[model samples]
Target: MRIQTILALTDFSSPAEQALERAALLAAHHQARLQLLYIAERQEAKFCDPQARLEQRARQLSRRHQLTVQALPAAGDALAALHAAAAQADLLVMDNRLHGRWRWPTRALGLLARMLRTSPCPVLVVQGAARAPYVHVLVHAAGDEDSGGRLLHGAAAMHAGATVELFHVARPRRGLGLACGEAFARALRSRRQRVQQLAQPLQSVPHTRLRVSDAFETRRNRVGLATRGLDPARQLLVQQQGTRADLLVLAHAPRGVLRDLLQAGKAWRLLAGPEPVGCDVLLMPQRGPVTARPEAAGDAPARQSAVARRWTQAT
Candidate 1:
């Protein structure tokens, strides 16, 4: 959860520029190295010098933010290049509007989802303008206790002084047949209790004590819990809108075939919906076994194994 390096993906669009600005602010805040990656298509490369442009921008950002910045130029497939570049990065920052102008929202969401699934680091999908440092962060907590703790810790680490609220939605069991008001109330109470128990460990830990790194010495972020009815995606949106949170954090776990058939992914639904959530989103992958990085044969396993251990401990 300690961010020492951030990779910002850009196509030189307005949205991409905004995302880059946000990334710069974060890099400055964390005192981390910022890498600007510009992937040029074949046709674009044939006409313009992308490497020069990227270097110029990197210089501007470095001067503005007073941080180390590197310009990375690549040609061909954007996704493949990003995956490769992100292997050593702690976080990937990118605009929600990616690629082709027409039907770009859908395409961008699809691309974002893919990046979230595959990226070795957390992906920050910039939606709103980065006016200032994050103030209030809304985090979605599912049934997984460990994931919730990690999300809380990560959120606290990333935005040190921001207030974080852990939001959970409980759905009643179908076969319970709790048609009676009292029975339904009991079920709701039970679910809420379970969620509270899951979050107790996180809440009990003092936020100021969380020491991811020197740059991330978090203030006492007032952690609170919220439970609501079904339709998780909609409820999350509503909760964010109501609280006016500047950032939303979600765990990007793989969906089963049954879950996909039954409902759209929550992250996809929120990002791709007609009404935007009006907040930046940080997607943390619920990783399983670590994938071997494309590194030297001797060094790759040791490095990847260490990374796996860190992630395991973090969760």
Candidate 2:
């Protein structure tokens, strides 16, 4: 996953702005070319006003990041416009809508999922506030192996010598084990090594830490979701990327992750805020090869694709 070029699609909302902030951090961190995109709502050909607004918005976003921006207004669907523009992208970053009419179903996550299913590159979707200090990267517990492996592989490949940490934040109750002491230590060790195996070059990439928190405060039915351990995964990734990570990479988790986010109503946070403090983020979607995972005999060659690589630019 070489993110040589990145595209950020904005709807000109606060959420979109947040996505732009994330893009800027990434552009600055990786030194990758950043393209800011705005797709105007379709209007009659005689109407130039919307196109002008779109261009103006694109320029504003581009100037903020100190890079070239591309604002496009098409006569068709907003999603179609974005999909057309992102043909050459290594990654696409967008905010998740959290409230009112700007909720998930209307936002780009579904489109993101469509893109993910067949994207030439990976897609990263951030809604609401994620966690901070992204020294670690977590893959979804039930994600495809390549999706899981790519997170570690990409981190290891990057020459930054940044430590790679991977952990699964499971929903409360069922998936989470509650034993203490040795049981906890053993579980952590096993999961950490599993992450390392995918990360490769164990010596070069150090282990951070992994934890399992109950998604809910208690096992009983609750009025509203109080995201406990696993809930923080999305929050940490979204919030921490700008400040701590040069960039952050994550695969799409199962519906459980999205559901919790929706319940929390943090969708707006996905687009409005400044990027992970100082650092930028790379929100990646799965874009594995035709045979993403292969047998050791079959996979070694592709596995040897290249060490995780980073695209760096001067801030």
Candidate 3:
């Protein structure tokens, strides 16, 4: 939630520039240090001086945003360099079109999925321009309870003025044969109740001002659920578009399930699919059972207690 250092990866393209602008805006708002990293293609680097350009841009951003900005040196492997740099950062910001295209290569998608899975901090994928501050933040709360709470806290902390809404999509049980109409109705009711139960704990997190919504509600109601036959990923996308959210937050899938999600599941579609969502996306890495060191000092205990209170309040 507390961001002290942000790393923005750039290739000097338009999307990257927009991402940098957004990152600078966040840096200014949070009083955080902003580090600019220019990733150049091997052939392009041979023809131009990347470091000089990177430093020049960093200086311009520093003067413009009135914040500390540093240009990181280029490395041989882009993914390796990014992973190494992200290790020390509190947040990582990058454009969706890092390769100068929206439809990414298989290898690139694999590397990105790996980074999201292993990054020490949250990753922000900028899909749109930074015209203004985010007004609506939609967080996917269908994963681990702890992960969902952490994401909600982070989103609330980062965009304090924005309205944060938590939503869950109840996917129909798989491999089950068709049921009678009455049985199907009962199943639907059960799923809706389960989603409500899952979201109940998040409503009481001490520091977060979250608006929890039932995705299964009718179309006439607020935040209506997606059509019944769609997968959870498509359902989430539909809900995000319906709510007109400026930002969408999701926790990284767990290790055992991560590979499938990245390769052909929801994460893949949202992150690297042909169709792009209207809002920016933030992906939080899954934390382990043991507590890791806090990104910011002096707030670790308070943050932990806040999460603890969420669980305690649920019971």
lDDT of 3 by residue, 1-315 (tens): 789999998878788899899999999989999998886432364538777988999999999989999998776776777878999999999876423343344424444555666788998988889978788888876543544467777777566567788766543322222112222234336456654555454455444355655344324221222123435566567778778989988877545333553456466677555655678998887675523222446543544454344323322
For model 3 the TM-score comes to 0.72
Inter-residue clash pairs, candidate 1: none
lDDT of 2 by residue, 163-248 (tens): 44443333232222321122223344656656446545436444433323221222321111222233434444433442244444
Evaluate candidate 2 by giving its C-alpha RMSD to the native, one decimal. Answer: 12.0
Alpha carbon lDDT of residue 65, candidate 3? Answer: 82
The TM-scores of all predictions, comma-separated, are: 0.70, 0.52, 0.72
Worst 10 residues of 1 by lDDT: 213-222
- Output the number of the lDDT-best candidate: 3
Q: Which model is ahead, 1 or 3, in terms of TM-score?
A: 3
**Relative to the true structure, how large is the alpha-carbon lDDT of every model?**
0.65, 0.47, 0.67
lDDT of 3: 0.67
Tell me the number of clashing residue pairs for each predicted model. Answer: 0, 27, 0
lDDT of 1 by residue, 114-177 (tens): 6765787888999867779888878775533544467776777666667777665422332321
Q: What would you estimate as the lDDT of candidate 2?
A: 0.47
- The candidate 3 region of ten consecutive residues with least summed lDDT is 174-183
